[model samples]
Target chain A: MEPNSLVKLNEARRERQAAILLSEIGKGRDRVIREGDTVAGPLGEAVAKAFRSGKSGMFELDGQEFFLNVQVPAPRIVVIGAVHISQALAPMAKIAGYDIEIIDPRTAFATPERFEGVALRADWPEEAMGDGYLDAYSALVAVTHDPKIDDYPLIQALKSNCFYVGALGSRKTHAKRVERLKEAGISDERIARISAPIGLDIGAASPQEIAVAVLADIIQAFRKRELSAAEQAKGAA
Target chain B: MSEQKLTEHLAGNGPAKDELQVAQDWMREGRNLAIATVVETWGSAPRPVGSHLVVDEEGNFEGSVSGGCVEGAVISEAAEVIESGEPRMLEFGVADETAWRVGLSCGGKIRVYVERLG
Candidate 1:
């Protein structure tokens, strides 16, 4: 590659990286870095790999070497209730590299002492979710088991691009909850996105175990969505 | 590129962006430099592929292709690449005796491609 072109390429890459990072979009586009040739392309495979794995790497396509540098936003977990399960879930999620926010109107339960080191919001779900708090990178878990607390957030999650939406309840409870959502004008397709009974059915009997199950389910949903998005981008390319 | 364009690019995020800015700065100051990128890895390599290490003519460097395991060798080779203006592909693995000498105790393999940056 010519010195001038190399400079141009690097500048373009930096611009794209900045845009993705500032937006917390976790997306990047880079071309094959090669010697003597101006080998540039969409870098579809690299983009997809970076998006799915959240790890960047270099790979050869058709014998040409390409470097994929990805910057993924920190994944976030928004728990709708500051209950016992949330107490377990918050710390565990933090250990797994997720920024957690606990929301509950009940100030007693949402105290800083109960949920140390985690962001606590003693406000209604709708109020807490106002602007930049919720996005595609966020996972919403409604563990309050209260329709007033969990339902509104679940509806908001469905309306937005939240990757995962889970609500803690029994099968019977979820059925009734679904009927209530229908009455609230939430479409059946959108309501279906909620993972009712909240977590992976690991037969969890304690708050800690349930938190584990919920975290596992959230990760599963996140990975699956990333894979699908990568596939879609590849198809479009 | 213009100074304004360069500044705009540096305003972006990520470790790679920072590395690129450093490279550009060193180049502007007339210092010869080379970049070594992790092109591939096998088994339990510490750093992911696309990880980078930039080396200047005086052996000053930043970033990592194999964490602390094989960076010493990469930096050494990178300095040579800067002087020679030649590119080379380097590979290190547990099965190789050099791997043990370089502290690749994690029993993984990594391939790094070294090249001069304009």
Candidate 2:
């Protein structure tokens, strides 16, 4: 690995961009490839697969061996509510290797006692999530169910192209939310990406069960996220 | 875990330093450095592929290629690689002749690539 390549790879990781360090087995030459950069032929296919799977391994192409060291930023959750559902979801997200940050302006609900070991922000979402705080690798879950609290981040998540954007609400509430988002000038196509009635349709009743459903839904969305950034829709990974 | 340990974990003080970052910093400081990366692993290898163990000329290391197993040998080899500017591939497993000496206790196999960073 060249010192310059190492610097570039670390820069990409710190910036939360996906990259792979491709090193030839015996030649001892390596280069860094960003998520969208194009490489030709069989090696390109292996590179794309490595980016998608977030796995690093040795690949042998036509007897030439290369090692792909994949660096996919760890996916995290940005929940807009510190309510019961988020309280339930926090630990589960941590266990799944996804760190979570809870942002809610409601102090009583966002109390530290309710969110142990969780990154809690008792500020409005607009203030809490500054520019570039949300990205394609994060799953934005807005469960506040309050228009004032939930609307801004949902719009921002769509604009930021979050991989998964979900909201906790019933069909009736989602209908109203949809109208509000449309009025806010978000495209119908963009508004359509919000996974309202948030979570997998697992017949969840309790807050904990709802958390489980949401985690499952986000996991599926992440693993199946689009490979080409040019083709992904709003809120698609 | 103890209360202090749990609080430390919860408070999210990040680990000391990233292995790659350490390698870069050492390079900038004019220290001789070699990096050992787990290029491939099979069975229950402790660390996954792409994991790095950066070693300085003095055998000082900041990361693990086998979760503390087989690191001594890797660091020793790193000195020679730093001297020659040539890369070497090392294989460790329970089936190897060095099993009792430097093999992975986890009953797994791993191929490590060691090279100097310029």
Candidate 3:
């Protein structure tokens, strides 16, 4: 069958599964598991085991079994500089499902008031971004062009498996910053991943516009879209 | 099981079969019903390709293909499908004037299959 037809068939099959699951409601003798129920203890263990194996299981309830599956999506966003762009980017990123956290040494800049709903860490970048702070899904942005702050975090961010890493600067500033990054031991290949002069070339101007560009770049990175030669060069080195 | 548990299970599982079973049951029970499914999408379509919506004889709808733009037309077509006993593939593109009237942000095109599930 054609791919579209196959998709339709698969969807039909899924619909059938939903219908079966719905029909199973109240048809079994056993009850749905509630929190802290001893009867569900074994079933819960089995569910956990199944989840570890990337699958789920069916539990027998009064001679009938019902399948149970659980999926947990990982979420984390770490902004290296508590700049105005970070201020704008944090909320929008949160809306996109990231658990936002801001790390900067400037206590005045990183505060609860500016990032009301976000987690704040007013520690030096090198000290704040500890082990396990950066993960595979973590999206990090270095907007504070201050080398004292941006360079250290860039190294740490490159070392970690962050899904998106973008830096904000003018082209000349980024070029100089790249030289500094090289001095600090980031290879030409590894440093290529940084989206310096970050964001789509939308001619964005103000801090808000810059934030928009940065977020768009991150979205593009997330989608793994075809990048421009400049973007590819920045991403590869 | 209590009605609460039943409703909870339905909400949690949210499987296509659950919706299909509901739709098929309604269809078998002599109710006119139209089922709309997203078959293809390009660009930044709001919903995924396999999203579904089922409408009853009276034009009541469950589920969504998008925010709203294409749904009105889709629901209308779905109702016709239920009445006519024929399946129709309705394609809406961002560039389509009617598409913007409904609210597609981008020019992503999507194909919706409307069939009388009965």
Highest lDDT against the true fold, candidate? 2
DockQ of prediction 2 = 0.72
A1-237 per-residue lDDT for model 2 (tens digits) = 799989999999889989999998777799999887788888988998998889999999878789999999999999999999998899999998898999999999999998877899999998998888887689999999899999999989988767899999999999999999999998888888899789999999999999999999999998887766465432333
Ranking according to TM-score, highest score first: 2, 1, 3
- At residue A148, what lDDT does model 1 achieve? 85
Model 1, range A1-237, lDDT digits (tens) per residue?
124534654664543321111100111123333211222255544455456676665656665665555545567899999999999998899888888899999998999999888899999988888754556678999998899888888878877766789999999999999999999988887789899888998989999999999999998987777444443343223
Cα lDDT tens digits for candidate 1, B32-56 = 8887777678997756776778789
Better of 2 and 3 by DockQ: 2
Error of 2 at A63 (Å): 1.0
Number of the top candidate by TM-score?
Answer: 2
Per-candidate TM-scores read: 0.66, 0.90, 0.47
Cα lDDT of candidate 3 equals 0.63
List ranges where model 2 is wrong by over 4 Å. Answer: A232-237, B1-14, B94-104
Reference-based lDDT, residue A154, model 1? 84
B28-96: candidate 2 lDDT, tens digit per residue? 998988999999888887578888989998888887776555777898999999999999999987344
Could you give the candidate ranking by DockQ, starting with the highest? 2, 1, 3
How much is A14 displaced in model 3, in angstroms?
Answer: 28
Window of ten residues with lowest summed lDDT in model 1 chain A: A18-27
Clashes of each: 1, 0, 10
Better of 1 and 3 by TM-score: 1
